[model samples]
Target: MKLRKWAMGLLAAGLLTAGLSAGSPREAYAESKQIEVSFSPVHFIFGGEELDPPEGQRAFLYKDSTYVPLRFASYALGKAVDWDPDTYTVTVREPKAEEKVSIDAYIEERKAGDRPILPVDASALQPITIDAYFEKVNYVFGKRTVQPPAELPGIIIDGSLYVPLRFVSESAGNKLEWDGETYAITGVSTAEGAKPYDEIVLEAEQAFQELVSGFTSEFYVLKSEYDGADDAGREEVLLQGARKLLEGQETFRSEILETLKAKLKAGNYYEGAVDQLAAQFEDKKQGVINLVTLFTGKDLTPYLEKAEKELEGK
Candidate 1:
């Protein structure tokens, strides 16, 4: 779907500002009670326009420590950022569309690197070494310098990582403008783009249907297994859950079919719809598996019957 007119304007402005920062490596970092580190943002030009931010964009601060949502920044900037719970490192990268980037890239780069000059005041805070943090969270940051143990800070808030907004915007060939009054950051790409709305709606419908069907098949399998079991109460509870799934499936099916009919009447081609549906189906397969596991207390094999039957008809 094409971004709304206002959103496009914001993106364009954001990209232009981002492009100007290409000369020098901008220092994007967060100040926390424990430590401070430097980093850069990933940039990209997608379909000749910058992509929008990912969901859940927020900023936070605690005990004078600032926390920025890394996912939104990375997703919006078209960069790859991953957290390793095993190590407390935040991996940030400028990933190409076709490249297979991994979270380990940051750690490898940093390990083969040098320690950075630590700030004087930051030296007094409790030492929360990145290596120690990584051991706690299984995550690592990209190449950067760190101070010695004596100058380290204590208690790192590894939950929310921060970055300079300008770094991400400029790197993506866009501009970032902050509205002080509204506290909103507006990112403007350099160009315009669009996706078919009807197509998206149709695809969403198909995905909803498939998810329902999968759940239904899994529900039946569990029901069959528990049919002659001695735990009558448990069986009743399972049956109720199955009924809910069935009702949900019917509702989802009706919604999708109605939406498709409407789009078809409006002269929308089914190609986009089909493409979206296929994508969604592929994406949601894991989610379906997770759900089945939760309720069935078994593997996903139980849900295969309904999906197989549906596919055969297709």
Candidate 2:
């Protein structure tokens, strides 16, 4: 594993000779006698980017080699480091994912003209090998650039790129913020405010009046026409009106049954009137559903939920 890492550094150096270096690495040969453990200030660079180091620390230097600090170096490069007492093992972990919207889904939504779901530019996204994300640390997103934190600050763990989550979020145009008190992470809202889920849904008890009213009206109207051909286009018109009335209906849910519900709300005797209206409205719903099924060649019964949802915030 050490040899492989060492080879990677050399490969980076080889790229350097060809003007291909983003802190690809090379190791130096050294002897203990020629080393200097000093308080002398020195600035570090990974690729072309500078690294800030702590004061008065040893650089593990020999005449030909220099050693860098791991914890600070990794942190500077947006990686976290941990030490385990059980096995004396050190581990590095990647940053948390900002959001679950996939690149493919983002592209699809963009193509569909929907609101942008992800925060990335999509055009500037670059795919890097795990080694590159870890080893190079420096990167560019479209026109934006990142400078490497320190000398080749990354590790190869099982051949997966574990770049900072910030990189993905930045590539996708997602904004990130830290909560200092709770140490929590948050992504900026894609929408303005929270969804009014409560109004979007009606509990059983709350829905009783509206549901029974809408359903009962449709019922009796069809019953009246049971002995005759549903010729009066009145039923179709009422059903369509009823459907539209329920769409995003919180502010005006009872609009279709407005007069009926108003009477009920006002404690007026209105049972017969509402049932008669609903019965007449039945023909309207049937005609539309039949034609829609014929044209689409599928059961639009599934669309009841859709129609309801469409009116969710309207």
Compared with the true structure, what per-residue lDDT tens digits does model 2 show for residues 97-153?
Answer: 531233223223323222222332433433332222233333433233333234322
TM-scores, each model vs. reference:
0.25, 0.20
Full-model lDDT, candidate 1: 0.40
Model 2 CA lDDT for position 267 = 35
On lDDT, the candidate that comes out on top is 1
- Look at candidate 1 and tell me the lDDT of residue 279: 60
Note the Cα lDDT for every prediction shown: 0.40, 0.36
Q: Give a tens-digit lDDT track for model 1, residues 1-314.
A: 33234433333243223221112212222232333332112222222332222223223322333233444455554455544322234455555554324322322322312323222333333523241121121222233222212222222233333344444333333455544333335454432342333234536665676666776676566666665566775545454544455445455546664565455434422333334444655555556556656755745543354444554686
lDDT of 2 at 156: 29
